[model samples]
Target chain A: MLQVIRNSLYFGGVAALSDVSFSVERGEIFALIGPNGAGKTSMLNCISGLYHLSAGRIVFDGKDITRLPAYKRAELGIARAFQNIELFKHMTVLENLMLGRHVRMKSGVLAGGIYWGKAQKEEVEHRYAVEEIIDFLEIEHVRNMPVGTLAYGLQKRVEVGRALALEPKLLLLDEPMAGMNSEEKEDMARFILDIHEERETTIVLIEHDMGVVMELSQHVAVLDFGMLIGFGTPEEIQANPKVIQAYLGEESLLEVQG
Target chain B: MTAVQSPFAIGCGDFRVNYTQDMAIYKNVRVRRRVIFLVILFFLFPILAPEYYVSLATMAGIASIGAIGLNILTGFTGQISLGVGAFLGVGGYASALLTTRLGIPFWFALPLSGIFTAGIGALFGIPSLRLKGLYLAMATLAAQVIIYFLFNHWDALTGGTGGLVVQRPSLAGFSLDSEMSYYYLMLVILILTALFTLNLFRSRVGRALVAVRDRDLAAEVMGIDLFKYKIIAFAVSSFFIGVSGSLMGHYTLVITPENYGTQISIEYLAMILIGGLGSVMGSIYGAAFITLLPVVLRELMTAVREVFPNLESIFIGIKEIIFGGIIIIFLIYESEGLAKMWRNLKDYIKLWPFSY
Candidate 1:
């Protein structure tokens, strides 16, 4: 459903990502694993159109989305939950989720201001959809609370809920389980599984937690120093010498065999 | 959507069943009735009050329109604008030029002037995509200076320092020439502006504006076009300010460069600050307070001067100091502004006798 063909991104004098290529089949949870500064987020940013690619192309659902704006990417069934929670802090969780459905809303300024006719109906419909996300994420308690006031784990859930509110065909979760407790990580893994299975959403997740990554992802791509060193199933990636070397120190190669 | 019953309810319980009921302007029938009563009282005030107070009401109403406009840009959209005075001038001049030069009717010129100001405001808003907060404010400040300069120097069009004369509007052959008639006109427009602004928050564009304000980057990633919304904010805000300016010009029968200088822009900013940011009702409260402050201060100063003739000159200077001082106090003690204070007071009253 999504293909990143030899995508490269540069920032100033440095190449954040270099010739990284990957493809995810539809309705699969794809994991991008890497150590600190391994270009996982950069790859997601490129695919989401937050950063312009220095080279190559991205095809999503058969369209070349290489030059599309971030919002255009969002409109084309792509949604992202940032590595750091990018939810609107001053807004309620519900408001943040409602804003996630912005591309679907059709009300212009004048019609929105009047808000008694078509605009009102659209708002209600979107609100209902947002409520389902709130329920699905079990964030009904914090639905009316401003996102800033929520705990980090709950805030991450809210961020995921916001992306889900898009009813996205492809959801990009950057470090969804980062900074989360074991219980929160488990819950997030479960939710990601549910989203993949029930909602049939194609998810590209960037996670540092190797355990969660191994358990949840159908396919795994490992990056080290802006290079995709391994791309395979969890079992294959675990046994790959390059993946093991990139993660464990070079001296720990014997430890991997042990 | 079952209505939950409150145990020992002190205030009215919200029994909203559907989205419409939940999002209703008033929470309940009682609140709606109370609002209607308040509106009725507002319309009746000019009839019962003295002519001077009626004139003050008209000015307050006009200021409210401009304040709401400023609030939409600065308060809701998080775009700090110091060019409100310029936008108002653009409207006033546009209306004046349209009526005087083009021989258009007052009714026609008024809306056209709003459109003209909106165009200018949108033009000024382009830099906001790259700039934020104080930088954007400085850009708008530049707009104020440029527009003000045009009003002063554009002799062939704006009549320069001599100013331009405006005729009161005649609607359906009934002239709105009297102060009472003009007050009614301003009051009606103020209500419509309030309603439109209030309803705006319930819909997509309003949420988008607030989202842009809260986090523009997040809004962008959520598929909200930041530039489009920001320009829309500027255009909508300037439209209201323009309409108010046109109304003011017609009411005063004159449009001058001095009327829409930087000081007036600061005053409009003060109105939203003191009233409340991101609140339609707060804009009205702030406008009324700021608009009436000078008159009230003058009265107070005159009364004090009568008692202490030696300190008469100091009282004249004290008004400006007190104005600055009050805003400072509000900023320090009640940064949420009068709307939050008013909400607290209402909550206090609701929980009266218990005093919690």
Candidate 2:
């Protein structure tokens, strides 16, 4: 459950997002679709607490999380998979996933330094959880390899697995299937579906592929410039003239009118 | 990521059976045995060696502690500091003052000095949240200059460059005044510090710090509080550095600002750089190597002076050049430091006859 009310973002007097309002029910894959610079990523960044909005409030799981720090939002089960694959490059995939378990872990420096009793147990427990994610993503083969050395598709999968490692309530995925092949994209789509169905995790996804967006997302919101131009069920959104006009050329819409 | 295996081999000998085994610090039976053997050898070294060698080892041990501390900040957390010298001074001065003024026992004074220096180090580290790379390095350089100035000019507190004389500590009526006794003490402390550091990198806190170093933005989104961990790194690093300073002060029975100059800070940086930036054992190796270098160079200079009477001054200049050149060479070719070299050597031996 997440709601954004009249969110506005400005950068040096230029609006990145303006009055973009939308809400997602507790267990749905909501898609944010737009052309280049439609502020989909910016909106996700604001929700994840990376970027601060100039004039708006974001209410997540019934709490106003507009002012909470990024880490605090993560603690509240909002995890994100970056479009550009921002996994810790030098660390092994297992270590990167363990880093996702960082907030949940409570071992202090002393206990960690000792590493004989509770800290060891804590680590093993988190390792088991991380292993589950690795299994889910089928990354067991390269689990010990540094994330930076992995192929692009594996890195994207690890990004998703990292977000899943947080056991997040609301996961934000930005261009998860971008630059992926058709087979890889299909695998990612299936993984996203399984994550939604099996875990009941709410997802806010930003994607470029229109067919995948229509097939996977229950609700779709189209943005053009900084404004939310359309919001409805996937079928309704596909039929909406505004959504087509925003995505296709303005000349196409004008030619139709003529 | 799998290593090439020999065709004649039946199976890989170092297979871990479980997650616990996989993540175990000692790794395998052989490694555990080697660690025990090394521990025994270190314990026996000072007993067999002469007093001069013992003293060198003691100094190297103390330097190892300080280098490991600096590595935690610069190498692990990716926060470069030029203020290690000042932080060490804070510890030395803090312990010196505590023991002389308050009449505290040496044991209590050591930890107190660490905490005091940690406070100062954390204060310096606040700038790191907003600054990075060379900019953060400059801020810490300011800390070095400012703290050294206080140590130099502060008349009543720091003795105004005259330096303070410290007393050797004893444990349960047994005096640590002798070089051998002090060497044993230094060795024990060094082992503890190494153990703590090694154990640290195997745990959650260590991974978080490394994550911060590699990708702070991603680390932050992963729910790691970047500033909190950075400050913690500063405090923890300074704590050990302070302890090392306290040990050094007591060993020599002197506390002087001259010992903790900016040049000394650069030397500490050199220790970690030459050892291995992020490896704990590399810090120890670098410290020992750097510590013995001047002694070896001096021995060489004296040997050459006997043959060529007028060449002593040039040798002094050459020693400096040699030291600078070694660091430059490490930066160019062996930047991973001795730790990686050690690893490569071990892997070579293990994979011999078909090492690939």
Q: Per-residue lDDT tens digits of candidate 1, residues B293-319?
A: 989977876788867886768767787
Model 2 misses residue A170 by how many Å? 0.5
Clashing pairs in 2: none
Q: Give the root-mean-square deviation of each candidate in angstroms.
A: 2.6, 3.1
User: Per-residue lDDT of A1-258 in model 2, one digit per residue for the tens?
Assistant: 899999999999999999999999999999999999999999999999999999999999999999999999999999999998999998899999988888888998999988889999999999999999999999999999999999999999999998999999999999999999999999999999999999999999999999999999999988889999999998998777787787676777776667
Cα lDDT tens digits for candidate 1, A14-45: 98898999899999999999889999989988
Candidate 1: where is the Cα deviation over 4 Å?
Answer: B1-12
Minimum summed lDDT over a 10-residue window in model 2 chain B is located at: B8-17
Interface RMSD (one decimal) of model 2: 0.9
- Please provide TM-scores, in order, for all candidate models, with all chains considered together: 0.96, 0.96
